[model samples]
Target: MSGSREEQLAAWTAKTKRVGFRQRNWSVVRWLAALTVTLLLAGLAVSLLDYPPALAAACWVAAAVTGAIMLIWFFDPRRFRARPSGIS
Candidate 1:
């Protein structure tokens, strides 16, 4: 609060970058475990419902594509900021 606006901005920027870096630095094992669990759960639901093979495969593919899209959207730093109202 006591510093110049530029100093405050710089501090905020550094803190944001540090958080983003930490998010991106997650271990491979952790990533794999999360992915495995998600896929396993999806597969389980598909199996328990007794869906046909083709339908089950389609469902799996759709889930994967959707998940990828969601992950990309979630991790994009720009998504954290509000868009200007007139930009649309």
Candidate 2:
């Protein structure tokens, strides 16, 4: 019956909806934070090797801010609605 076919399509579409969306959101945020933490830790590690404390602090702060940005924007990219490259 047509009703049965509709139900099957709906069932399959629901599974896809439950799948990629949350994982993609999580993956972007998680990896961004990991990268930021790595940068901060690397900066800290190199400061004792004469990288300059001010430079190290700046690196960590920059990383933290970038990570925070990713966290905020991970929900939706369309919300930004602008060309980062400045090309309309």
Candidate 3:
């Protein structure tokens, strides 16, 4: 019985191993990039429209930070980690 349980668990893990993880990560990166671009454009518009310099600077800074995070997530070496046994 113990052997059978282990086998079943192994099969289940194999079936679901890293399922949707890559898709979800890519989706997150896409959204982050979009947000960064939007912020950057907003900053540019604000500056062009003669808005407060501080506000425009804040927007640009936020865009830079989000862009950095997106790049980091995209280039990270360790992408996936297996779930602990019996936790799924």
Best by TM-score: 3
Residues 2-87 of candidate 2: C-alpha lDDT, one tens digit per residue: 56988988877777665533324556677788888888887888787897788888888888887888877676655343323432
Q: Please estimate how well model 3 matches the true structure, expressed as its whole-model Cα lDDT.
A: 0.82
Give the C-alpha miss distance for residue 14 in model 3, angstroms. Answer: 23
Clashes of 2: 0
Give the C-alpha lDDT of model 1. Answer: 0.62
Who is ahead in lDDT, 1 or 2? 2
Root-mean-square deviation of candidate 2: 10.2
Estimate, for each residue in 1-88, the C-alpha lDDT of model 1 and write its tens digit. Answer: 8799999999987876656532342344356447655765776677789876666676567667656756775576654544334532
Model 3: per-residue Cα lDDT over 59-85, one tens digit each: 999999999998998787564444456
Mark the regions of model 3 whose C-alpha exceeds 4 Å error after superposition: 1-24, 80-88
Please give the distance, in angstroms, between residue 88's alpha carbon in candidate 2 and its true position after superposition. 41
The true-versus-predicted C-alpha distance at residue 26 of model 1, in Å, is 19
Cα deviation in Å at residue 46, candidate 1?
3.4
Q: How well does each candidate superpose onto the true structure, as a TM-score?
A: 0.40, 0.49, 0.61
Ranking by TM-score: 3, 2, 1
Question: What lDDT score goes with residue 9 in model 2?
Answer: 89
